[model samples]
Target: MDTSALNEALAFKSYDKIADICDNLMLQVASEGVAFQDEWPYAVHLLGHIYINDINSARFLWKKIPVAVKEGQPELQAVWEIGQRVWMKDYGGVHEAIREFSWSAQTQGIVAAFSELYTKRMFELLVSAYSTISIQDTAVFLGMTEEDAANYAVQRGWTVDSESQTMTVRKHKVATEQKLDPSKLQRLTEYVFQLEH
Candidate 1:
């Protein structure tokens, strides 16, 4: 199978479209009755799922990969390590895995993208879930050094108590309650009445 398209997609950081591209290519390979020759595409496809925060899909893909391919390709194994960390909600492990692996040029962009997205997600979760959090925990969650995490919290308008080494999160303002649509409610009531009758 020609890999130019997959390479092109990676070059442009088109992560969202990678699964579709790989699926179509797999189909094409199957239709032609040829075995998969390259392992890089599989690695890219798996990382693409990770980039989109689709752990289940990434797990499914991992299961589908042949054992030999999984064993032979360290990059693929590294990608799966990140997926495992994500599945376990081991944020520190995720950062550690990303840092420890020597990612190839082709997969680097998607891995970096996933790292940034995951950190952003953790930041949002911390903001919503914590009134105040310790700098060490925030550093682990944000995949940053303690000093960098402290600075990041301050930059985001969070108040850091230097003596306590804790940062007060800036909570988002809760939106006012949305007005229910009368027509939808009336239809639902009529449906319930009809069902009861």
Candidate 2:
């Protein structure tokens, strides 16, 4: 099957199309026991950049590159370097690589993927830093309406306020059984409360 379609989809910024192709590629590679052969490395590289989104998984795939190929192709090494930086949450390094890495027309999607990944990491950091975030802050960060921000946060288990100014994590009540051991239950309750924060 022609998995190169993923490359084209990525170049055009049709990233949503990449997942199925990568899945199919994985199945095909698994069924055939294809290791480091016939564009498998490139496909894995694409998965690393565009789909896997984890340092260890991508690094695992990267190690499968044939020694000869790893040494012979400069672009492969370059791609690996760029992908590792992205996986490491080094957005500034990625931005510098975008300008400095010799990107051919065929590889333009790597830039887009890196940019999206960096933005996603930034958003994750921004959200994680706050227990209670205002709708205005959410709207500004996401470029959406306050209502949309509240809706989004609510869907993700955050509680929208009466004034709709902030979204806090929804706290669940601990239902303790009176019959259970009191000491163990108190410790469990304390652990649960600690996790909420």
Candidate 3:
């Protein structure tokens, strides 16, 4: 997919727009028997990120948070609900629906495997971010070899302090006032995923 296609797919402000794009992408992957390795998961994560990070959009989508809390549901449940809504809106609902819109056995298997791998990998990355994990520990957690972990860190431009047994993700000081472009980052992510694809 081209950058414009990605941008168009992600720029969807309506559920129908996103649903169409996602359903198409899923169908393409299924027909080709190609796994949804990189861009696929990144696209899903990007949508989740946008929902949580975009003030206006997220404000609208997350309105149920307080309602869920008032009803005495767990906060995580609320978050999960939001996530589910985002997924359903963008991706033509869920697995059953996506599967029902299937292609062939090989294609279906590819899509299923890709979805599992993408979600698992994303969860591993998210969990590591919230925990004090060693490189080897995170490598195991992500089901990646140590070299793959190191390579990813390098790609992210994080400094590896081997002697200290830690890799420090360089933080930009607000005082310096630098910003990363969301679209650029998305492109980089897409490009990386395309390599695996």
Name the better of 1 and 3 by TM-score.
Answer: 1
lDDT to native, each model: 0.88, 0.62, 0.45
Candidate 3: tens digits of C-alpha lDDT, residues 2-54: 23443454444332244345546656766888754433433232233333333
- Provide TM-scores for the models: 0.86, 0.50, 0.28
lDDT of 1: 0.88
Model 2 pairs in collision: none
Candidate with maximal TM-score: 1
Cα lDDT for residue 190, candidate 3: 98
For lDDT, candidate 2 versus 3, the one ahead is: 2
Query: What lDDT does model 3 reach?
Result: 0.45
Using lDDT, rank the candidates from best to worst. 1, 2, 3
* Structure candidate 3, residue pairs in collision: none
lDDT of 2 by residue, 124-184 (tens): 6556677787777766554346786578667768787767578785544568876889899
Which of the two, 1 or 2, has more TM-score? Answer: 1
lDDT of 1 by residue, 39-71 (tens): 447788888888888889889989889888998
